[model samples]
Target chain A: MTVRDPFAMTALDAVRAFRARERSAVEITRSALDRVARHDRAVGAFLRVDAEGALAAAATLDARLAAGDAMTDRPLAGAVVAVKDVLATRGLRTTCASRMLEHYVPPYDAWTVARLRDAGAVIVGKTNMDEFAMGSSTENSAFHPTRNPWDLTRTPGGSSGGSAAAVAARFAHAALGTDTGGSVRQPAALTGIVGLKPTYGRVSRYGLVAFASSLDVVSPFAQTVADAALLYESIAGPDAHDATSVDRPVERADLSRGASVLKGLRVGVPREYFGDGLDADVSAGLRRALDQMAAAGAELVELSMPHTSHAVATYYVLAPAEASSNLARFDGVRYGLRADGRDLRSLYGATRDRGFGPEVKRRILLGTFALSAGYFDAFYGRAQKVRTLIARDFTEAFAKVDVLATPTSPTVAFKLGERTADPLAMYLADVCTLPASLVGVPALSLPVGLGASGLPVGLQLIAPAFEEARLLTVAHGVEELLGRLSLPSLD
Target chain B: MAIDVTPARVRATADLARLDLRDDEVGPFAGQLQKILDHIAALEALDVSAVAPTSHVLDLACPLREDAPAPGVLRDEAMAQAPRSEQGAFVVPQFVDE
Candidate 1:
């Protein structure tokens, strides 16, 4: 096997080696599992590691290859991918980073998980996540918090922090993560990787543990756009299991095409995204990134999203309200950890009391109150209206520009426990990310530069719904310009 | 309107959700829940009478499938993790006696 540095190989590179007979699928899978064993102690990226299962799957793929299968038929064959704990994998313990479901083994694989298996990809294991994907940082996870690979003292961003950190630490070639609000993108930014949140309904939600059903999306995190696109292609399609999945055809354009310039593309910079609370270093990095695009022949325009400031407030209300309802299933009756009690009522009470993490409880209470009879009109109802305004702002802007660009997060990864005591400060991390979620748009976060604290910053590019091709095209161009030298070393 | 979530309300809500809470937890949770509610309450100030409530992002009607026998968890495995169970069913205390 070509084991110069297992962590450095992309999914494509590993597949190529397996096809060329230079390495067997078993060798690549073992290398990946070995890397996880070596580094996961410090990174805390995975909650469960299926070393034997992954090896067995790899052996099967190797046997299939020996039977003379065509490479084109199984492009992702033999590639190892990590699944976030929130996405159910049949027979594998899917925790959703909460104690309530810690021992719950799902009966069926989530839509995405089935797709991955169909594509011949070996599942490495389930990575950690915030309980029910509710928090911006993975610290809200009932299990151990994931540490940033670049700097252990810093956060890896969150909700999908484990997925991002896993990919960053090279524990997996690619990882699937859910983005509700900023779950996937912010973590990608913090970890110096690429994360893509496809348009809502573009991917099925069948096996995914729901946080905010309307806003949540399953996406991919990888070192490059091509890798993310490859993973997305495998998982994006309508599913009979999920009514919310869209039946749209995948747009097949040459994503890897080298365009010397972006001359005709109109890149809009929302004035609201560049305003007051943005960190100085983040602003500088964004400006420099825009300048690079301009130099490469793209037209830059300053646009306005009038309802931008209200996005965070609307999201806080709407998301929690949905979360409250979706999480009602874990009542200690059907599955998972149950608290001891003498009576049924006490059983329910004690189970939920001990099962939920602090953040999950707080959100459940907040959401329930927001949707209550007396408060519905004032909180949940009004947030829905504001959501429409936010969506309209994006629609208006897209009319004038092909794509909009902004900083993925206002600041780089903060110190561990920095904003844990101040919920408002933590909510602000999603300020630049929530607008796109509100509108059901496709967005990409690509590492742009390092911040003053030497952490990574991401430049976000958003396109209209189902316009992932255009977004990927622009992101690829910018990524090439930025170069991969900017990637942080976990060592 | 700023609604103050007092300890009494927290306890009541806990009861509604069927979650047990200690005396110490009620006070802190009340304070934290009140702050969160206050943050969410800011939405009430906006005017949204003309805006339509969007429940889901999809434009398609809900697709219905005919009932069919499908592979599901075995009864024993399904109840394996349950704290209390009887013959092929989850066991719970009887709420009333005839």
Candidate 2:
């Protein structure tokens, strides 16, 4: 165990060190905390750090280990995991990066948070994100936009930008992020980390502040596929608290048990995704990735998901519609910030107006209009119907291939204020990622290579629902072929 | 055809969403909503009447748990974060004006 900078070790390596008794839990936790202190000022990844709690948890784990407890029961034993602020952590302030809940602390742990605790993992902090997880860039966060570690001027790509940046900057072993219309994968792509958005029902959503209920999914961001899979294993399964969680038993992913090669695997290339707006360098990088997979014996089949074009329009409708209903709970009367007015209705309006950011307000109004009695069928109804077709497109493609391959985003991380002015242009950032979210499939983003702009380009591999194991394994195979990327210099 | 989102319609939708908007916001919101609606109008071109609407892609029913009582966040604790509350209940502005 010749580890000098413990922060640089991959999460899996850190786990191995812990099991070997080479590194004490406190040492690892302290290293992670130290790194956050050093880099988080520039990164802005964390909204709140639970330093004392993390140390206490580490001390307890060390005590258990000293008592000759093998600690084999906890797969993620001693790993430091940062959670996105949207999850409700018992007695810990969970702001969801919105002023509405800036001072609100939940009375109970979210299902995934409890699972992480049970797995002997240390909760490092709550990360920053788009307020209410409504925007594509972290710029919409009420506090401040998290800068990309790769380039100080660029955004990390959000609303999971903070989590992605934390992992990329090595602020923690790994972090949990939620993906509603590509929040996790897109940021992972931009930050040059591995992000996995499991099938919708794969991970329990209990205690996760609902964004777009049906589309929202809890995901993990890590330096490697195996590390992400480890975090995935700890938090995924059936939870009685979350009715949407699948009833199936949890199966820990076995990355090594699967075939080492991508031989004979059918990989689909969606022709519609290769259309206009994809950067030339990103396209070239994706082609090179496809070629690499072919060399590894994976067969590439070009297919058309004609409804891919409709995904953005469909998602904007369905997601905001759900968000409107979900956000209605945040009125002045209940928990969260309140503004008193002459009447209840005026109070509701005043509180929301004061609480929500512009992007959240925009989406709420869009959703209210979509679900309005006069326009429901034309907007929300049509979008849902189109959503079905989008899912059907995936079903048809999966029938012909094992997984679909595409570039995670059209371009690398754009400048911080580049698309802030144009909501439509900002929405276009999710153009490639929304289709899979609409279809309810498992998707993984791996760093393929850097692009012409000298920023990272990510290759997205998507599998059918509940086929997370297959998705991760294939992603692992790809990651192995591509090798690890160099860490971004803090300069 | 692009649906027109006039300032009146925007004001009405804002009211429906329970959002308080300023005079300056109404014009911009209407204009922005119109642009998005114009983009979303592409969905209208496709004939999806034959397709069933999927609110959620998963085909699973809302599985009901056993009718068992479990310890929930205590009243005092839950009320601790409430902006305004009465005795063991959330306090709101006057709903009925006598």
Of the candidates shown, which would achieve the greatest lDDT relative to the real structure? 2
Q: Among the candidates, what TM-score does chain A have in each?
A: 0.97, 0.98
Error of 2 at A10 (Å): 1.1
lDDT of 2 by residue, A1-491 (tens): 67877777888888888888889889999988988998899889999999999999999998999999998988787689999999999989999899999999899999999999999999999999999888877999999899999998999999999999999898888999999999999999999999999999989999999999898999999999999999898889999888889977656566773335588999999999999899887899999999988988899999999899899999999999999999999897778999889988999999999999888989999999999997899999899899989988998999999999999999998999999988999997799999999888999999998888889999999999888888888888888887888878574
- Give the poorly placed runs of model 2, Cα more than 4 Å off: A257-259
Ten contiguous residues with the weakest lDDT in model 2 chain A:
A252-261
**Candidate 1 lDDT for residue A114:** 90
The DockQ for candidate 2, computed on C-alphas, is 0.84
Per-residue error for A242 in candidate 1, Å, reads: 0.5
Clashing pairs in 2: none
TM-scores for chain B, listed for all candidates: 0.83, 0.88
Q: Which ten residues in a row have the lowest lDDT in candidate 1 chain B?
A: B36-45
Looking at model 2, residue A167 earns an lDDT score of: 91
